[model samples]
Target: MTLSLTAQDKNTLRTAAYGAVSLIAAADATGSPHKIATHGSIALASATGPVGHVLAEKSKIAGLDGKTVAELADHVLPALTAAMNLLREQDPAQAETFRSTVGIALDAGVGARKGEPGPALTEMRRKISTALDAA
Candidate 1:
């Protein structure tokens, strides 16, 4: 919830977030970050808080109730990217902080939703945390 990330990790998350968006946007002819930027913007709006609130709010609005893991990720990722991009243009520093915070939240969300790479990411985080704690 309040993880302290290194600058590099922050950048990594930002890149991943944006990359996920690009992937989804390119996959669909009509989907763009602008179309769903609102959802992600909310998440980025809160840099010092857990991003679960924003993501959950968007999920509810998107009718994620009965959707498959892949379906939810497909929808949420793009929206988040669009929002993050918009937030960056609005406030780069704040958006960067929020991007890293949301990265953790997004990873957890994917795992909870049984997304395609959710388990892998969850496991990787666990391993990384363990290793870091041991250091």
Candidate 2:
């Protein structure tokens, strides 16, 4: 079966991706001095709401509180992967665009924090790209 995504679906996925990255950054910020700073905050906020709203929305979708980074990642990654797969099957161009946009967003998020992304974010990026390749 071909899985198709409407514009709304793409928007949801985009929002979710931003939320996921924000969730990870917030978690990292707790322990590290580096935070998303001004640019990252603006980037994320422009897409979704504040970081807290994104986390809450994603958490509600994942059916988890997402109190910790691990918990959030566990839920967000799988959802994102699935969404990518569906988008790839329905519209390859859109899938590519999503992947690129998410990658750029993630990078901006990390750059704002002035630190490297952890393994989870990297893995999610890889998974999104791989889904497109596999399709």
lDDT leader: 2
C-alpha lDDT of residue 72 in model 2: 61
Candidate 2: which stretches are off by over 4 Å? 1-15, 30-65, 115-135
In model 2, the worst 10-residue window by lDDT is 48-57
RMSD of 1: 12.8
What TM-score fits each model? 0.37, 0.57
Cα lDDT, model 1, residue 58: 28
Candidate 1: tens digits of C-alpha lDDT, residues 1-135 = 244444433443444343343222223323332332333333433434333333222221322322443554545444445545544655565455555655544343333322254344445344333322221
State the TM-score for model 1: 0.37
RMSD of each: 12.8, 6.6
